[model samples]
Target chain A: MSLKPTPVSRASPNRAGATLDAFLRWREASIIVVAILLTIYFQAVNENFLTSANLETVSQFIAASAIIACGEVMLLICGEIDLSVGQVFALAPFLMHFGTNAGLPIIVAILLALVACGLIGAINGFITVKLRVPSFVTTLGTLYILNGVTLTLSHGSPVETGGSEAMGNFLGASPYAEILWAFAAVAVMHYVLRQTRWGLHTIATGGNLIGAAEAGINVARIKIGNFVLTSVLGGLTGILEAHRIGSIDPLAGGTTVMFLAVAAGVIGGTPLAGGSGTIIGALVGAIVLGVLRDGFTLQGINAYTFDIIIGAAILLAMISNIHLGRLRRGGGR
Target chain B: MASALRADNIVKRFGSVTALDGVSMHVEPGEILGILGDNGAGKSTLMKILTGYQSPTSGTLQVHGQDVVLRSVDHARSLGIECVYQDLALVGGLSVAHNMFLNREKLRRFPPGMLDNGEMRRRARQVLEDIGVNIPSVDLEVERLSGGQRQAIAVARAVSSDARILLLDEPLAAMGAREAALIIDLVLRLKARGNLSIIMIMHNYGQTLDIADRIMLMQRGTVTYEKAAAETSVPELMDIVRREYRAVRSA
Candidate 1:
């Protein structure tokens, strides 16, 4: 046999060309462009869309959706979902109420509520992973159970909670507190997803479970960790929403909010099929959702029309992203 | 010279089924040992035992001629034993660099748990280059690569992790002629590079002879015949298999 080097192409010879390819291949780039266009379109349609007072409403929408989407993105990348997260959201404020009534400080009560949410997430993970149930089924079961528990515990009615003004302002009553929390979630979660070993393992676990296991990754730990993360975020969203409204409602952040958070994630390029996702993209996706809702309301479009638009828009964005990805790879299955 | 890996008197049973019975094999340093067998020939079971995916019921394993027991896949890997299964274990959604690093990503010291992706990419490229495997970019996801390229990456990953005893399970099972040639070339290159011992559990007789220095034939959970690849002919191996089939039928 003749000893000769097999001719194989080295890393793309042209640096600039490689950079262009990476930019095109990045799922977030196109989504960002779409988000910007939507924001501009909304600002144009109604001057009130960007007004400080109206912006507060938009920020609230973006904040809640983005925070939940951030958590869901991690779970989605690892091929799990928590339909119960919204229910956890409703249960948290009530948990805090119970804790405060039990003589705990308001901050301690809130922490306790978050911890309870994390435990719920752990249970979700345990049931799904150990019981061999598909996460969709497991979380779906927990969703209704938690909702029922919240309603039963709350006596099927909304109640107001009295906390210090500073605590109220710190939580969500301030004009931009929730949005600030959302940005922090996006920033830190983005780091965890992209820059940490946990994030890489999560992607690998989702991409191929057996392969990840073969590589000695603790697959159960990664999945369970993500579940806890998502649930904690859900509980926090609930607490923030409650404080923002100065009332704890048994029906807060129900299926509607859960679906919106998931929609934000899916729109931001995290396929429900798993394997890959982006926190920053999810944040922008939430912004897109917020702008559409706020913009449509300002234009006197009814809520029903808004739903139709959102559904169609998500489908369109996802379809385009898929096709564009294929095109970027020069086409093929 | 000490064998890179030695499995002595290995036996495995799974609840009333004897998957492997009294199987023994060894590969010397820098040697490619091919285990050719038909389906249910205990090839996979032996490979599993060798890779620590399973422990033999009664056999002992030696790495670098030192007696040791492999507790798990991670244990086997730490002992410089890596298996590239038929599935290749490449996560298609990940970039080439990420798949190469997988569970063993390099982390930044100061940030505490943050990946040093730049360093990883650099090392990934260096390793791939050292192995003489090349592609368009390390940033490209594994799914975009052809089957052969993906296989090459899996092998390169093993090599990068410093695997001394590499097991290739059905490395050529589903590949087309060109892709098979690509892997054959890769195995040959790794052999020429020295210090890495390979045991290929394969099906094709001629391909095995071409790539391996020695061949061991297994049938019904035991090695039926063994010979230097240079001395063995395809007809001779086929004749042995036919004789075994005839004996089984007569029994």
Candidate 2:
């Protein structure tokens, strides 16, 4: 009468099929299958798709988006979003540059830049939470403000990334460095979301704000902390990109990257409506997007056509995810 | 024994509008007290003050014979006061065990900040079992459960925290007869434990009489009537309410 599973599981005597059904019922399962199929198709389309060099190139694309998606997924699950994170991404390397100009060491400059980004996130959080402005509008305003600040500081010109070659390689110049950072971010965030109280509170905050508050979960702090995390991660991704390209462009990242990160999260099964999300699922989504971009580029698809196809792919993924989500919510009975 | 809770001449005002006006009530230890009222009768305001969701403009509250002013919901909980709201206060996306532990999660020592999910699940199961809640599994998200089950979980959470005073705001509202019966049984079970003092703000007359040991009726921000539930009938309550309605209309 208590603590037992529903009759559905007992009625099915085939254990293996039941296990497989459960696996498929997971939110990440569909995306993982999609990523695998894309990988095989790309490899078949072009021999170079699986080549180590080409794989590294594809990973570079996944790296930035996946890292940002990790933080965005957390924010989304908590019912907030940071549109200015991409702008913060464009701002970090320049802040680091100014730090070095002020006689700070490279590492110190990088840390300072990240700290500054965290402050920006706090501002975003305060304005959204305390001022009662919607987060989207708040971040949108910061997005423009950050962009203008970066452009004015750089005089609208690109600058060579100032750190030593060794530092550069450590950040993102090496083929695997950026991807490694992304993977690390994913692993730590996955643990946080699944194993820590902070993550559980974040989910609860999004699930039902009044309910979370009634339970004494400190909903505001959870939202503010996630905002800070998203900004810092965004800054880190920007710095990595600057080092990888050996130059910092005032226009790098901006809206395109933010949208891609958000798209990855949604495709990974984190709903825009909030309350639930999966970090590993975001990584798989990033992989799917990366495979499409790099694979099409390898097959010589034009950039314009690629955008159209990517747009269509995102739509298809979202529609399928919505249906799959029904199965998930049905408890797989 | 001292009453488990006592509110002395409580008054609450929202700007120029008075919500609760010089109302006083008390509930004996191990007793189920039902507060009945219509909409805008200050029932919610009084419940809010009791749960420390809001402060009274003028009043004194005594819990276990100790005079106190509750500062916030958490402060009230620290004094062993817990509320199961009409909304149930359960996260739809969270598992039953997760919702039960919520802010007070059990943590593993070695990992420093990681949740001790296994321990939480065990304790949640024990608590639910002890309270006689027939949850299918603690791992199921609360949204998957029926309204009665969700209400039961909310009560289980309150009891698990050792709440000496339990407040339920419209626990049976919008529920079917069977669902309401489930909660009624659960409430009776808690009362039978002989420790918790229960206060339910309700709109249903017959149901309140069936469950509460004593009942108080509120009208226009004041206590209009009070009596033992065993001595009150549905028609008697309806006549009183109708008289009050007529008086308001004539005035």
Candidate 3:
């Protein structure tokens, strides 16, 4: 009996076209192309745009947002969001500062701060999943509560974290230190999201909660775990930033950081609607924003213009992502 | 031959509404028991109870003649009861292999909870091929598949899990004739294996008569009739259904 050929044929002539098509269809491919083009344009406009020192500075600036984005990507994939991540980012550092002044060991202080963030994450998860409250509302309430507590505790002033000099050096002495943490978060998170059962469950939870539950997956656990993961990552980013910057600024990570991290994830092709996401995509998204901001600054563009350009870029990326997703479903050419 | 599954007087109630009223049924090893019911006939509720999606209000469930309490779908699965739901319970964003191994994923030795994707992919391909499913790749996401292929994948997933008793809820619903035929053929092939017992809930009497060894007709949360398939005819089942409908309309 003659067997019928499969729909996805692998003939040699079609293979070449298919390879190119696969590249074009990948969500990150367009973003990479845009980043490269932007780099070329920046190089033409300014001599210092491609300098190693300048690149290092860009990496330092992007690292915190990148770290937060890594967590946000996972949460978003599981069909939820944490608007309070920005507050956790600021609150964690202040908690650390208070811990150090209270005579706790530095590592102990950091752990306490992270624990606080984890508690907040648990609260968010409990309210959202158990109480059936919308996550957007739950996290918004958390954002205010955390912001209020941080402001009241620090009295809206920067706390001088008087730690050992070795601690400071170890935390953020090298320009690459914070960037290394960001990359480490990305690498670890990427592995968890792609190569683990936990990640698969997360995707399934977001894709179809009822379906996943019927399949014997613990949907609540997956969602709650993601919330905790995002908040802990946010707290860690705050600690690293505080150590690098030499002080815990009360108002350091406001809604701007939260928005930027969320935007990075969205720009990286992680759908806000959930079901699908990638950590590597978020990392590249952070770099794209970093390169844009750095290049525009080098070209003497006003800082205010950065907002307009970045906003437009996010919209464009979203449009392309939607189209690419449709193409993958064989909806349109 | 011993029975594979036995549901004794399964009763389900949601507040004042009674969904399944003392429904008792059984399927012998390798036999296909066809459940025939209309809307609100408690067909789905009974399936849910058997599959551990929901607990029966009051019932004794037996698998291989041993009484067991299924606390959850996972528990049911552990007891070798696997269900292919009408909606298919598939994650559209996940690849075919990933969806097949949804909660029962294989972990790598080194990473300790990491998915063994390569192994899963290989096994998924082999299982689908062994089952004679004509799919190009297991790497493709389920959303890209046609309705028939998607149904096939769901059945393949259930069967590959070593389920001794398979519960198919409206497997041929909303499917084209060819797709329905494909599923029927798959079901027959599984029956030929002789280790698996099948309980298929279907709407079509003729189709049910075509594949089932025994036929069960349910109406208003109760079984109205049960008979050997060879002893019952479609017109006889239709007359019984019409009588139930007339009684319901009068009530």
Candidate 4:
């Protein structure tokens, strides 16, 4: 007996410019197009835009945000968000600094710092899942609490992270080192989100919580795991930045970076509503923000105007994402 | 014939209200037991208890004559009991193959937790084909499929999971005639296998008479009638429902 394959009704139209039309139809593909176009436009507009030094600076600026965004993408896909990641990002390095100052081994201090962040994540998960509080409210409260702790510990002052030279070299010897960490995070997380049972479960939990539970999936565990993952990545980003800069600034990585990371994830292709997301899209989103900021600076654009442009760009990307999503669903209105 | 499942004197209470009162039933291997009831007749509650979604407030459940304690949905599934719920419980954004695998995903040999996507897709295709569901692609997200197709996938998921006993809650509700016929055919084919038992909750008495070997009717948390389909008539079932409605109204 011959089994015939059924043809997909909504296959892309076989017409002129089909490749371009297909690219325009997909959210991730369109974002890549915009990123490439922005890069070319910036390079053409400024003589120093494409220089290795400027490119390195751009990468350094994006590295920490990209790492945080990778984690946020997972949390968002799982139907939660962490406003406290920025506070955790700022506080982790301070913990590491104090630990090393107290004669603890550098590696031990880093682990201790990560453990502290993980604890915060667990608290966030506990409140959100077990206590029945919305994650938005729980993370908001933690954000304030963690920020206050960082400020009180540092006396609102910058402190030097007097780590061993070897630790510093391994963590933040060059600007490229931070980029490597970011890419490594992207690769690992991308694989986990796409190729693993945990990843599928996360998507299922976020997609339909009750359905996942009925399917015998431990929804609570998936949510808690994602929260811990997000916090740990934020903590790692903090530790890397402190090692590179050689100092812990209590005000560094404030809520601004948290918002930027979320924006980057959404812009890259992950919906804020949960159920669907991508890590590579988030990486590109960070790069897009980086290119925009670097380009604006090179063009001598005003800082306030840059903020407005970024905000507008985010809104535009979101609208396009929604529209394209509808288009894919048989062009439903 | 050996009984596949037996629920004896099950009682369930939700705080101040009793949802089920001493409900007892048995399903034989290869037999389709049709449960007919009104909106709040405790059919769904009984099904939930049987599938381990909710434990009975008091009672015992037996599988293949062995007394068992159902701790969770997974526990029930381990005992070879599966339920296809009315809500369908499908993740709309996931591909058909992904939904088929859901919590029971197959993993790659080397990487451990990594999903074996190629194998799952192949198996999902084969399963759907065996069930004779005409789906365009297993790669399509379930939300993209028509209503009948969605129902087919949900039923197919339960059928292909090595279930010895299947509980279907309103499996044909809100489906078109063609779609309903398709599900009926699948159910009959599974019955022919002789290794599985089915308990179907239905609102339509005629369809139940067409497919069920035995019919059980419930009204207001109690079993009001039970009879072999061959001996019972639709008029008799309606008379039982009318009498129950009168009793409910008088009380």
Candidate 5:
């Protein structure tokens, strides 16, 4: 489709304001505004919601999820999904913990974790692409294997994730400063997805893998790269959490955060079917959910109720975003 | 001129199904070959094997006098054998410039390992302009573009890759009259470039008659007839298609 849809009702190009207004009414921006307004309103209602301490806590909580979600967004955009993210996330940190405990330097441990996660991603991609297995099922299998590995290694107990004081210093200022890291990470990934050939291919793959391959996109590489991004983010999160909590729990680095990350992505307007959405929207979605969680907790909501609220919010975001996505695709049946 | 591509006795079977059996064809330099067949006539399978999307069980493929194994799509592309599948594979979420140069992005050094976007957008615009693909904006996502525009960009992108042989599978399948005409025009312009050999598989006989120098008919994984474009009529071609399909069904 070569033509950008201009409202046929208006003819004159002389009126810049009308065109600008139409542009501003883009669906992505509208949902983001709604998310922001809800956050601000809740913050107003509960003073604790606006406090530096809670914001710091939420920042740390959302940072890892946000990071993992970036990779998920890229993968999903290509019409593929990485269910192995939660597992790969755990796998990387586990590698670092086991390696670092045995005597490798912290930098080396972190590098190993990053590299291992990347390889795991590559393997997952290879299996999916080569075998022609649906990424969903392949990643799901990897997810189970990873989870089993984490459980077996940790014996269902926390692993001491210690080796580098320098690494600890690099991940935080009580985690809010971690937001700076998250922002920078998001920016870098955003640039990659938007500006680079790899980034374009990832989007293209998500949009139409057939078309992407025809256009010379190494769709498998894009998928592998995305898988690595998702896992690396999760591992980085694990690395950060290990540093933050001063220990790593197998279940603590689990699929719930991965689910939440994806939910935040969908809520932020990244379509589940792929080839749409932005890193910025995902970031905003992460923050919006973080704020919503904080606001509810400050209002003295019960823990179970909070889960119910989050689950509902995730469902709402999925339905609304999906419906809007359909409209954007010219209301497909 | 010598033939640019030759497929000799290509045989591909999927278990009980013989997708392409003893199929053969050749494309001389700068020739436009049209292939016609009904659904499941091995059009895609033969093309797939030729373009390295699939490997034939027994066959010889020669490009520029070298018998090459069509191993992977990337490998095929590297050899300057390009394929445009019927799906018109375009990522709907990307911008026109981005789509026009999806994998082959023009990257400029930003800072050390970083990249420059300003250059990529500029290159995209330049390519689109060169190919005469008119999009309202390079920044607008492809979903916003019309069907014709998308096809134009897809064709333009394929031709831009400096491909010596372009295999287009059903490029006009689902296009309206106006869209189809423009694409046909694009094909003629590409043919005029003189270094490119084109093999287009199409259902629309009229359009194929208009552009192709020669036509080949296949039925049930085998070539049944071949004729120069000027030598065949629509009714004759239709009879050949029907006759081939009947023979295959009875066999």
Candidate 6:
């Protein structure tokens, strides 16, 4: 006694297309379209937007940001946040600073940085998930502490990693390295969130923790893993920046990256209120932001003006993404 | 087959308020039991206790004729108990196949440590097909599905878990007319699965009578009346509910 949800499955071509269109989710479609449009605009304005040189830069920026944002997206989707990213970004390189000065191999230094950064994430997870502290407050406190540690380690001067050039080149400066890494990040996360049970559990954990627990997900463990991954990604971004700019500074990575990361996430159609978002959409959102910023930069615009523009664009994207009034691209029924 | 689930003399208190006082109920295998109550009748509280969301201060809970203790949701699920919350609790962003396999996803450990999507989609499609759920494609995301389809997917997801006892909280609360009929039919089909037992919490009397094999009327944290569906009419049920389940009218 079951009737088809849709009558006439093989009906008119137009109707079938409409039915399919109904299924393309709004946020994902909009983010991709926005990313593409921004790319086209930048390409038209300046021959630089799509050139191999600028393309490498885009890949590196996305590689760094995507690594951090992917974790944030998972955390946000699971109803958590990490405000300590900038600090984690700064602190990880110091692990290299100390490890190298102490006569360790560059590989050991990088591993130390990853572990130290991961520990910071673990503490955040403990306070927020285990101790029942709000993530907003807990991570904010961690931001200060990590910043302090990095500053204390740096002693208010820049330390250039001249000898560790090989390590830096392998992870940060290698041409097209960012593209491979970005592709790997998106592909793996897409697979995890879509193909693996852990990915589903992560989404469910963020969507409705209570419901997920009832459904048999280890919510605490998932949140902990998300927090740790986010921190590690931020650390890697810091290391990449240190190599690209040729020095490490506690004050260099600004507060703008955090806001930018959060904005890309929401614009990707991942809600601030969590439960459902896609990794591909996240990459699209980041590209949109990067293109917007780079496009304005190529036009000889001031850096600060681009911030105002980005703020406005992000607000608009959020409004459109949040309001589900019309048919949007990348949807499904 | 004595009963799929049985709660005896369940008593729960919430810091000076008695949410469930001497509450007890049973759902025999192959029967659909509808729970009716007015506001503050402790309907939710009783269900929570049975589903292991909350522990009853004083009560004995049994599953499939064995004395059981439910310390957490896993404990309940291991005993074949599953709850379909009013929220439907499905992630809207993920695909139908992804959501269907959520919390019970298959792990693929080949080709350099990544989630295996092909297997996940295959399994999700099989679950949907086994539950008689047909759509344009199982690979489509859940956010695009209609409210009725989402709800059906949820119920199908629940029963697909090898659960013998299903607790559906306000399954028809927000559904429109056409949608409500579809859900009732789905529930009836589930009842025909003899090894399964269901406890449906609803406000719609017509739909309750249409699907439930027995009815339990609850009021002010207590069960006032219990009768087979064949022995009761809407008006007869209404009168007892009006007089005994005063909380509904007052609230």
Which candidate number would show the highest lDDT if scored against the true structure? 2
A100 Cα displacement, candidate 6 (Å)? 2.6
Candidate 2 chain A minimal-lDDT segment of 10 residues: A1-10
Give a tens-digit lDDT track for model 2, residues A1-333.
233333333334589878877887887999999999999999998999999999999999999999999999999999999899999999999999899889999999999999999999999999999999999999999999999999999999999897788999999999899999999999999999999999999999999999889887789899999999999999999999999999999999999899889989988889888899999999998998999999999999979987898798789888998998776777534
Shift in Å, residue B173, candidate 1: 2.5
Residue A153, candidate 5: how far off, in angstroms? 3.3
Candidate 5: residue A304 Cα off by (Å): 2.1
Q: Candidate 5: deviation at residue B241, Å?
A: 3.5
Better of 3 and 4 by TM-score: 3
Candidate 3 structure, TM-score to reference: 0.96
TM-score of each predicted structure versus truth:
0.93, 0.97, 0.96, 0.96, 0.87, 0.85
Q: What C-alpha lDDT, on a 0 to 100 scale, does residue B217 get in candidate 4?
A: 95
Q: Check candidate 1 and list the clashing pairs.
A: none
Model 1, DockQ value? Answer: 0.44
Error of 1 at A86 (Å): 0.3
| Runs with alpha carbons beyond 4 Å of true place in candidate 5 | A1-28, A87-97, A114-116, A119-123, A131-148, A159-167, A173-177, A323-333, B64-71, B112-133, B193-195, B245-251
Of models 5 and 6, which has the larger TM-score? 5
Q: Which residue window of length 10 is worst by lDDT in model 3 chain B? A: B129-138
Write candidate 6's Cα lDDT for B22-72 as tens digits.
988999988899998877889988878888888989989888789888997
Return the candidate ranking by DockQ, descending. Answer: 2, 3, 4, 5, 1, 6
Q: What DockQ score does model 5 reach against the true complex?
A: 0.45
DockQ of 3: 0.56
User: Which residue runs of candidate 1 sit more than 4 Å off their true CA positions?
Assistant: A1-24, A331-333, B245-251
Off by over 4 Å in 4: A1-27, A331-333
TM-score of chain A of 6: 0.89
Tens digits of lDDT, candidate 5, B1-251: 55799999999999989989899899988999999988898999888888888889998999977889988887888899987777777777777667766666666655443445566567767767766666656766777667777777777777777789999989898988878887888788788878799999989888898899999998878998899999998899987777766886899
Candidate 1 vs candidate 3, DockQ winner: 3
What is the per-residue lDDT of model 6 for residues A147-228, given as tens digits with 9 covering 90 to 100? 8877887887888865555766766667766556666777877777665566677778877777677676788999898888
A1-333: candidate 1 lDDT, tens digit per residue:
122223323355598977766676677888888878988898887787778999899999999989999989999999998888999999999999999999999999999999999999999999999888999999999999999999999999998867998999899999999999999999999999989999999999999988998888999999999999999999999999999999999999988888999999988889888888899999989988998898899999999999999999799879977887676666322
Residue pairs whose backbone atoms clash in candidate 2: none
